[model samples]
Each structure stands twice: as C-alpha cells, then as structure tokens.
Target: MIAIPVETDNGTPMSTKLFGNAKFFALVEPKSKDYTIIPNEGCGNGIQTANYLLEQGASSALYGFLGDGPFHVMVRGGMNVYWLGKETMPLDQAIDTALSETLVHVTTENASLYLDPGTAAGACECGCSHD
Candidate 1:
C-alpha cells in the first residue's frame, strides 16, 4: 500500500502540512482504490511518522514536502518514496497518478534536492532534534 498523509479521513485534496504535521495517513491500495485513514500517532515527529507508516504495511509514500529525517527513515526502511505532484491534488486523482509512475522517484541520493529539514522558524536541519 501507498501512504498519503492527509488532513482527514474525508479529505479531498491531500495534506500539504509536511510529513511531520499531517493529521492522518491514508493507506491506499493503488489498483483497488481501497484505502483506510489512520490517525497519525506521531504527528510532530517525521521519523516517527515514517516508521509508523512502514509498520502499517505501507511499502511506499507519496509526499509533497518533507524533512531530511523522515526522508532518510522512509528510504532506509526499504519504502519507495515518490514526490507528489501538485500540493492540492485530490486524493483519488493522486492514487491514479501514482500508478502511472510519472512522479519523480525519490531516493537517498536525491532526497536533498527535493526536501527541506524543516520550514518552521528556527527549525533545525541537522536531523539532531529528531524532527
């Protein structure tokens, strides 16, 4: 399953809140269009969220913006990561687009090219704060 962090279970457009702050994660079965929303127990920590998704059977994740910590954790855990197109893409449309394989495939080497440590003021980038 591919996990897409979202604002809610009924969210149309996926969440743009960045990986660590998403309120929920929708685990979608790409071909079946079947999905389930799970509340993010790790809403303030990117690494925790990434690990949580992995434990929930998500082999991949579609994300717009994320921090280095989560990006590393996701890829290190053997999960495929894709850069989500359009921050406002609808949940259903995103699922379809993901299967097409057009989205930029993210890997450890290219993670810095697309990710930020954090965008908040005074945010730490060393991944030392565990964000």
Candidate 2:
C-alpha cells in the first residue's frame, strides 16, 4: 500500500488535507516504514519532504508541480514520481485515478531517487519533526 504523508490543518489523518502548496517528497511502500514530520515550517517543499521520505525508506511519490530544486533531489535519490490530479478532486479519488490509469496529464512531472532497498530515518527527524 502507498503511504501518503499529507499536511493537515487538523490533527487527524482522515481529516487532514494534503498541503496544496506543500511539496510531497516521497511515496513509500507501507511495509518498510519509519518517519517523522518536520514541524512549523509551512508545508514542506518538494525537496525537503522528498528527502525526508528517502530517509524513511520511500521509493516513489505521487504529487503535482514540483520546483526545480526538489525535483532534482528526488532524481538523485531514486524515487519514482507521477504527477496527477487537480485541486478539485479529493485525495482518495486522485490516488485511485492514478492507479487505474484513468488520469491524464496528471503527471506533469516525473523523477526517481535511484536507491535500492530504500532506508528510512524514522519520522523523528522528518515527518514527526512537524509535531
């Protein structure tokens, strides 16, 4: 299963909203996992978030427009990226579209982290840092 590290206004996962302006850094296979959210930093930029995921054993990411810096780091780290969805769709449907291949032009950008048997630094330093 895909582990999505979403940015939330509330302290709830189902209630949480994926930070629209936030940069998604990693798409992790839930099986190999450990993570931390860096707190009080606005939503994480694509690069920092991505790096955090890399530190946490992520091999891929599913998100939208990424700036050059974060885009580059993801490539260097070996993460597979597929850009999809508009702000209109809810997160679950968006993810579903991606899986079903019904989504088009969703992946405006693409990159990879290139690491094998990825490693995670635990959420303490990354995702959990946000709390």
Candidate 3:
C-alpha cells in the first residue's frame, strides 16, 4: 500500500505540511484507487511517523516534504519514499504521478535537498511541543 499524507479529513487533497505534520494519511491501493484516511498518531513528531506508517502497512510513500529524522527511520524500515517536489496536488494525481515514477526517489545521501530542516530530527524552531 502507498501512504499519502493529507491535511483534509476527506483525504481528497494532499498536504503541503511536512510528512509528519499532516493531520491525516490516505492509505491507497494504486491499482484499485481505494483509500482510507486515518488520523496520524505521530502528528507533529517527525521521527515517529516513520514507524506509524510502517504499522499501517505502508510499503511506500509520496509526500511533499520530509525531514531527515523520518527519512532515516522510514528508509531503515525498508519503505520507499519519493519526493513530490512542490507539488501540492490532489490525492488521485499524486498517486498517478507516483505510479509513473516521475518523482525523485529520496535517499540519505540527498535527503537534505527535500528535508525540512525545521522539522528534521524533531528540531523545531517555533518552540513547539513534540513529546
């Protein structure tokens, strides 16, 4: 299954929020176009979302942004994550784009390019609570 982090409860549109900051996740089956939106347990905790997605049985993800913490956690857990670069598209198009493999596959070596420093490693400049 593919996990797409979304902001709306309906899960129709994708979120610009960093992966772990999304309010909900749309778990979809690319082939059947079936999806379910579930509350994100990790919420604003960047690193925790990695395991959360895994527990949800997400094998891959397509997100607008990611942080180094979750990047490493997801990668090490054997999940493939793609960077959808500035594309705040709807869930359907996002899934299509991912299926087309048009987005860049993120890796530790180049994670910084797509990683949101503010949210990376649970580092928040806004003095927010993550715990």
Candidate 4:
C-alpha cells in the first residue's frame, strides 16, 4: 500500500485541479525514507480532492479529522481514512499519530457531506470542533 500524507492548514483536503499551499507527501513501500512531494491546492471541494488522490493511485488517506460530509466524499472516491488530527504536523509524524491513535466514526445520508474532514467544527480555520 502507498501512503500519502497531505498537510492541510484546515485539514480540509483540496481538489487535485487547483494549485495551493497544502503539502502532499507520498510514500511507496519497500523504500525507506523515500517519500515524494506533490503540489496541492489550498481548498476547493472535498469530494474532488479525494477523487484526485484516487486518480493519483492512493487507496487510502491519513488526515487530521473529517466531519460527516467530507468523509463520505472520500469513501465514494474509493479512499479510506486511516487516522484523524487536530492540527497539521510533520508528515511522517502525522502518519505515526494516525497509526497509533484512535479515530472517530463519521456517517451521513448524503455521500458528499458525510466525509467532510474539514475540522472538528467543520471550520477550515482554527475554531473548528468535533467528536
């Protein structure tokens, strides 16, 4: 499995179409310390972002957190959430945190709104809150 770590300020994944400030670190197995960087768009639509990653060959995503809406977006795009986060950390460390920490369960009727990993409070900025 290939591991892709994207450092998002709001923890909101962005569409692959636009170019922005988020940091994307991708790791392919069997090669130690061989993570590659992909340019990111700050924010756009959550589902688009997941689809972009899927097209890039990622089967799963490790993120800080996701609300009901964006979570479903990822799922529909064929990506699974491995972990959650409160803020952006080092790509490698964030991956470790997700692997070591417990994650919250998110669900929604609308697939687009279900997997919204924007933030705890669904805010892209600092004041976001969640379970």
Candidate 5:
C-alpha cells in the first residue's frame, strides 16, 4: 500500500506542504485500486507518522514535502518516498501517477530536506555524493 497525505477526507487534492501536519492520508492499494482515508494520528510528529504508516502496511509514501527527520526514518524503515512536487491534485490522481512511475522517487542517494528544485545540488546529508 502507498500513503498520500491529503488536506481532506473526501478525495480532495493532496496537500502541497507540511506532510506532518496533514489532516488525512489516503491509503491506496495500487494493484487493486482500493483506497481509504485515515486520520493522521501522527500529526506534528514525523517519527510517529512513519511508524503509523509502517504499522498500517504502507511500503511507500507520496507527498509534496517531508521533513528531514521523517524522511530519514521512513527510508530507514523500508518505505520508499516519492515526491509529487507542489502540485495539488486529487488523491486518486496522485495514486495513478505513482502507479505509472511518474513521480520523483526520493532516495537517500538524492534526497534533500528542502524542495527547491534548483537548490538540491550537493552531496546529500545521508553522506551520498552525486559526483
């Protein structure tokens, strides 16, 4: 399952920022196209959110932005993170895009805490160099 942070529970567009503060997350089963919205019980707590996702069987996550701590925790916990940029599209569309592999796959080798497209131009803090 993949989790996409959303601003509302009724299939509204996903939030463009503040993954830790999102009100809801749409859990999607890619193969079956089944989805459900769950309250973000870990709101404001990145680690808690990561753990919650893992507990709920999420193997990956799609978000517009994520903090350094939570990103690291999620990656370490075996969840792949995909960046959806700043676009605010419906959760279902996001899911479809992810399934199609159109999102930027955030990895420790290339991830930056900041989302500025022109600013991610150096060795990642996780110690991987792009050179």
Candidate 6:
C-alpha cells in the first residue's frame, strides 16, 4: 500500500506539504484503486509517524516535501519515498503518476532537504569543516 497525505478524508486532493503534522493519511492500493483515510495519531513526531505508516501496511509514501530525520526513519523502515513535485493535483492523478512510473524517486543523495551543510561543502567524512 502507498500512503498519501491529504488535507481531508474525502481524498479530493493531496496535501501541499509532507506528512508532517498532517491530520489524515490516505492509504491507497494501486491495483484495486481503493484507499482508506486514517488519522495521523503520531502528532508531529517523524519516527512515530513512520511507525504508524508501517502499522497500516504502507510500503511507500508520496509527498511534496519531507525533512531529513523523517526521511531516514522511513527509509530504514524499508519504505520507498516518491516526490510528487510542486504540483497539487487530485489524489487519483497522483496515484496514476506513481503507477505509471513517472514519479521522482527520493534518495539521500538527491533529497536536498536532508543534505548537511558540511556534506554539501565537501567536508571530511566526519562532517567537520576545516576552514
């Protein structure tokens, strides 16, 4: 199942931001084109949110943006992260894009939100600046 953060339970459209502080999550099954909207009881805690998604049988998450800590937690839990870009479209369209293999796969290296300042500056492996 793929989890998509949405503003409402009706699933008309996806949230503009990531799952952070979201009130609901739409757990979608691509094959059947069915989905369940669930409340996010984790509050704003990233780790807790990740655990919640796992408990709901989510194999992947589609979002507009995600922070570093949450991204790592989701990745460690064996969940694929996909970026929906800057467009805010209907939930069904997003699912279609994902199923058609046109969404951008998010990874540590390419996820600019998670990049450390030292790492981006070509600092040592220890993440310490020599300057």
Best-fitting candidate, scored by TM-score: 1
Q: What tens-digit string does per-residue lDDT give for candidate 4 at 67-87? A: 444445556666555544345
TM-score of each: 0.86, 0.49, 0.83, 0.53, 0.81, 0.78
Q: Of models 2 and 6, which has the larger TM-score? A: 6
Put down candidate 1 lDDT per residue, 43-120, tens digits, no spaces.
887888888998998999988778777887888789999888546566777788888889888887787677754476
Tally clashes: model 1: 0
Candidate 5 error regions (>4 Å): 11-16, 113-131
Q: How many backbone clashes does candidate 4 have?
A: 23
User: On residues 27-122, what C-alpha lDDT tens digit does candidate 3 reach at each position?
Assistant: 988888788988989887767777899999999987776656677778888999888766577877877887887888888777767766344454
Query: Any idea what lDDT model 4 has?
Result: 0.45
Q: In model 2, how many backbone clashes occur?
A: 30
Comparison by TM-score, 1 against 3, better one:
1
Error of 1 at 60 (Å): 0.3
TM-score of 5: 0.81
Q: Which stretches of candidate 4 lie over 4 Å from their true place?
A: 1-33, 98-131
Scanning candidate 5 in windows of ten residues, the lowest lDDT window is 122-131
At residue 92, give the lDDT of candidate 5: 71
Q: Candidate 6: RMSD over Cα atoms?
A: 6.5
Best by lDDT: 1
Residue 93 of model 4, lDDT score = 55
Candidate achieving higher lDDT, 1 or 2: 1
Ranking by lDDT: 1, 3, 5, 6, 4, 2
Q: How would the candidate models be sorted by TM-score, starting from the highest?
A: 1, 3, 5, 6, 4, 2
Give each prediction's root-mean-square deviation over alpha carbons: 2.6, 11.1, 4.1, 8.1, 5.4, 6.5
